[model samples]
Target: MTEQQYNECVNLYSDNVYRFIVKNLRHQEDARDIVQSAFEKMWRHRESVEFDKSKSYLFTVAYNQMIDHLRKVKRINLQEDFTETTKGVQHQQTPQVKKALMEALNRLNETQRSLVMLKDYEGYNYEEIGRITGLNESQVKVYLHRARIALRNYLVSPENVI
Candidate 1:
């Protein structure tokens, strides 16, 4: 890729990739670092990257890096239990509602989250999502359907409503 193409790739994908990482990780600093790492890897490989396939390449790199980050952070934590306990403090929307949404998201496997985000958040079509995530179009559709159903169930549950 030329310098021009590299700049275009960054402009086109940075926000979408950042949002995806932030939504999953729920940490702005971590999301920014992962996005930077993904783009850096993409930049390093630009010569080999097809211009038409840049979005997919960026997302794939980001997804892999996110997995690695999660793996590295895996550990027992007493503070996390305290955090969970304090999460019940009352609020307008109620922590339970937010928790249910997060729990619903967590219920999805990694691939399902990718597909749902690509479709629902990024507004990518199934073919585009399939390309980005290395799945087939049909697989993307199926995973998206399942993810939506799971989220809907959580959101519409009687306890979740005010």
Candidate 2:
């Protein structure tokens, strides 16, 4: 990618990459660091990444960084714990239903949650999602199906809702 293309890619996908990381990491500061590192890696490898596929490239890098960060930390951090680490957290402002849905999402494993975000939130198709998560198309489909079902079951429980 040219410098101009890289600049455009940063403008277009920074928020997307950041959002994806934050949703998975649930820690805005860590998410920000991961997002920055992802962009830095992309910047370093700009010669190899194509402008047309920059979105996927950026997301893939961010996802990988998030995985590494999680592995290094050795536990999935929850939003409640994350809030204790910093002020002005936005978890207080979300609607009840969205909060419930997010809690349901939290019940899923990493792959499942990432699949849901890549496919549902970011509008990535199966092939693209597979490429990003290093899963085959069939695996992506099966995991995503299971994730949606899990979300449904969680939401169906009266105790889980507002």
Clashing pairs in 2: none
lDDT of 1 by residue, 37-103 (tens): 9999988999999888898888888977877887798621212221233343444655666677666
Error of 1 at 151 (Å): 1.2
Backbone clashes counted, model 2: 0
**Predicted structure with the largest TM-score when compared to the true one:** 2
After superposing candidate 1, which stretches have Cα over 4 Å from the reference?
75-103
- Alpha carbon lDDT at 140, candidate 1: 82
Q: What is the alpha-carbon RMSD of candidate 2 to the true structure?
A: 3.2
Which sections of candidate 2 miss by over 4 Å? 79-94
Please report, in order, the local distance difference test score of every candidate based on alpha carbons: 0.75, 0.85
What TM value does model 1 have? 0.74
In candidate 1, the residue pairs with backbone N, CA or C atoms under 3 Å apart (3 or more residues apart, or in different chains) clash, namely: none
